[model samples]
Target: MAKDYSLMEDSNRSSNRSIHDISDPSRRIVLRGGLGMAIGRLLAPVAAGSAGCASGARGDGPLLGFSSVPVSTADKVVVPEGYIAQVIAAWGEPVGLYGETPAFKFDGSNSAAEQEAQMGMHHDGMHFYAQDGSRSGLLVMNHEYADDGLLHADGMKTWTAEKVRKSQAAHGVSVIEVEQQGDDGWQVVRPSPWARRITACTPMSFGGPAAGHALLRTAADPAGRRPLGTLSNCGSGITPWGTYLTCEENFSSYFNGPEKPSPHERRWGLRKGGAGCRWHEFDERFDATRHPNEPNRFGWIVEIDPFDPGSTPVKRTALGRATHEGATVAVTRDGRAVVYMGEDARFEYIYKFVSREKIKPRGLRENAQLLDHGTLYVARFDADGRGRWIALGHGQGPLTAENGFADQGEVLVKTRQASDLLGATKMDRPEWIAVGPDGWVYCTLTNNSNRGTQGEGVDAANPRRNNTTGHILRWKEEGDVDGTRFRWTHFVLAGDPANERVEAQGNIKGDAFGCPDGLWADGRGVLWVQTDMSPSAMGKGDLTRLGNNAMLAADPHTGEIRRFLVGPVGCEVTGATGTPDGRTLFVNIQHPGERPSGRSDPEQPGRYSNWPDARAGGRPRSATVVIRKADGGPIGT
Candidate 1:
């Protein structure tokens, strides 16, 4: 077969009875004692600032534009002294070409039809694609998930069909044209054809080896290629070919309807109760058993062309599906494309797909098909600070009929099993990934609470027994960006230097933060790290002192990190993107007023964050903020 997508599925699937619960006894691999010690010794110097990160590749110009911003728990965004931030778009705001929708009512009163043309909630992972040389561009952003209490006029206690419809309308990607106005001001360019919405109800198709697999077929789409909408779009990336790659994370929570669980269904979290959304109550398709394959239709990387509003988003199956955090691309010396992705679950593996064909920059149609075929490889870090990319290709070692893979399509469908069979290194809830200007790869290993309590044993890559405060991991390819072998090291072992988490670990520097999640490498190679702390981890001890989730800048050369901006209380600092000129920066502040303990308190419900409108008593809405320096300097230079 002339394959465009990578192949090789996994066989280590959890039993149906225990699928939702991932403590699969049959597939546990433990590396104990000396092996773990050796790995730890190899990575010990990273916190001491001794190895791995490129020392001489610092970009020219000022390394930092302004002094570090002080941490705050205020209800507003605190930027560097001279910089200013303005709310550009919020949930329920009309974002398309003007006149298409009415002005948004600050209260939760927008109809489902109205919200379809409005900006979605929980704004995240945005990119600005320039049109007239940065003067104007299309801002494509992801709407991760929604909160029912604040999203509707009446809370979840009285959620009507209209409320459910409006909520679904708010769960996808938004593309709006924006232009710089009079010096530093930026606003949405209404009435532009490029301004549109792609929500959970948007039409999309799966392409690559698993496009028409049996697992993807649903009653609504017998062909198995067509799927409706993308959900829980967390981190995302703008592809070199000018398309937006919106990731589908935690898509498993949307489905309901099944008393007895199948192993496959359990693995994806398809159970009797919903993830509090209870959309299954209103829509039959949301019920997994009624439409068993609907959940499979999601969880793929969906690519969208922002410039073309009429384009049908494509779910690229070449990249194996899991809890996909996002896909960041790095081009090789020979023009081939390499996409680095994180599976976003504890003990899950990190993955990459290298396209078979070199990219031809001249043709959009041809370049769009580049992601269709590739060789998928999972990472396996060794105790010697070295790592290898194990191929997930069919007919390649271990991936065969005997191992549960019938073909390449099956390999892609069951990617987690494929990695297990290949013995890929299980990471600590890997989240976002970004390739730096120096051609090195950095990934955010968000906290894994179950590290010591269950599952995998401690290793150098994941040194902590219970990794409450996660760390930043960076790797350099042995030869080129496409090299199979690589050397890796820790960039940030997040925690306050004064705290025991830091003292016991002895791997982080003086300046630190916890739960490192959103990560991006700016044009100047300065690494921007965002924090997403759990409620239970906050409000006390060092976490309380760490304050609200914030964005920090790291000098790759010196490995010195400094806090740049702090968001309002209870908000997750996420999705950093700037204009090509690096003058204007865009960030998403998601779910303010979120409980500190990650649990909803009925007595004090919806009292966490009052952001974007703290002065007035209004519902907290996740919005995108545009930040610019007064002197028009490059952001985080």
Candidate 2:
């Protein structure tokens, strides 16, 4: 969700539905025989061992065994030569969870209650979990925002209330624990009782159907069922009962409103002077014209239970909130629970939800109300390569109340105007959604520079136009994950197939990297990906021959792709996970020397990257590396 907190603007005026508004544009790229023969007949029955794939991609032979790691404007961290990379719980470290454990003071002087026990700031979407088998676990992650010029200590000068509570205690979620120390590698189990730190001022609750609606009350939450935290925490998910979802992407650039805002604050882009993290001049709930339902208690998803560090962190709201960027659960073969999500903006839409019971063999107190009862839906993608989902249910079809949806909690709080009055499909910025050991699903579209310019053109599930390097989109649903029909394609179109400007040359089959953002898939079918490309467009122009931000792995049945890791100079390789005997992995990197106004000047904090403390004027934190395998086996093998 970076790209300087996603910029915003395009408030979906609907009329979307574009793949050239189809009507035999050559049956839109030859119907089902095109996105490369429908991704080789939907990954050729999961590379032929079908039946719901994922037995770790069935004894694979070359599902990426390493070796590829080149394009790296090196300020540090590039792996693949038997692999090693270390770093760990970076940004302001400590995270020993509560009380003392302080220690992260390279002059930013900690505070805000020691930046709420440290380790928060940048590090987007992560997971880990394990326990002892992988030698320890828990990790968690997502501190998606906060650079107030490297958080405090004279950065946003004179800004007070302890620099808005240390930039809302460096925005939310961290969890920690880690372990694997026998060879002296992954540490941080410091005070571990499963560590913690769910910040932005923690305490959170709210559950199903827009919990206590009235546009989420809030005169300091008179009854919006409590939601005093979790903001901007981007892309993350892990549940099957284990818990820890996070999400909330650009929470309307931390709000500000009223200069003529309301149309529900310009359809969630708020502004009137925000998107600059002024914390509304000192957090009166980020002052959206005086707590306008406190930015409807933040674009939701929350969840968290990373083995209960004294729980309390819910915000589910039947999963509808927009701007989310990550959720990815997938279950429904009767075990109910679907999820999926995406809305990272720029023409938005691509949600999921499903649930309504099932999933029982108990865990987080018997599935904690399975995401508070669901149904959401919203995808569309049609010009032939099929896709459907629709149901943003409230009085269905155009959501009734003669349009402004009067119930299901204002149709999940105007979930992008009930997905533009149920017509949906206007993507190109979707970001992270995984699900595939081969049962498809994928996602990631992270690009969309106002695709085909302001008048909004191109489509066929976003067939590049001004899309500036993006693409991944998979799909397959028609029967499982509570099917509402599905078919999609295009699993790779990221950049450099010898580009010159054919819509930023993509269709990459290996290595080339571009915006893709973080995605995962692993229990073997590989497909990792990552890349974000933004510190003001990295080395410059068409991503200057793609030099930094990388992660790549992919093999989803031979569409190949490789480049494993490479992040540093102005970072953003973004959150990945591993370890359940997959050896190690972890990843993250985010905002490293982020500039081009996404903060970091505090008198030139190492001017552009001093990654993992390359010193000389350090401060570029946002870490998490780890990666292993120097014969410890597993990981991309």
TM-score of structure candidate 2: 0.33
* CA deviation > 4 Å runs, candidate 1: 1-62, 458-463, 501-506, 597-606, 615-617
* Candidate 1 accuracy as lDDT: 0.72
Local accuracy by lDDT, each model: 0.72, 0.75
**Candidate 2, residue 16: how far the Cα is off, in Å:** 26
> Which candidate wins on TM-score?
1
Candidate 2 lDDT by residue in tens digits, 100-207: 598888768788888888888888888877778778877889888888777766788778788888888788888888888788988988887778788888888898
Candidate 1 per-residue lDDT over residues 1-637, each given as its tens digit: 0000011112223321111122221221111110000111211222001111211234465465568777687878999888879888888778875578666765567788888989898888888777776578888999988776666665566757787788899899999988889854888877778888888888888888899998888888898988888888988976656678889987767788488878667655566765657787787788887888788777888889888888999999998887789788766666677788997766677898888888675645878888989898988876556778999999899899997888998888778877877877777778898775444578888776666565446443334666677777777787766789987666666776656654224244435588889987765567788988765566565565688889988766656678898888778899988776667888899887775433233344347766776644466778888988888777775
The best candidate by lDDT is 2
Return the lDDT, model 2, position 136: 84
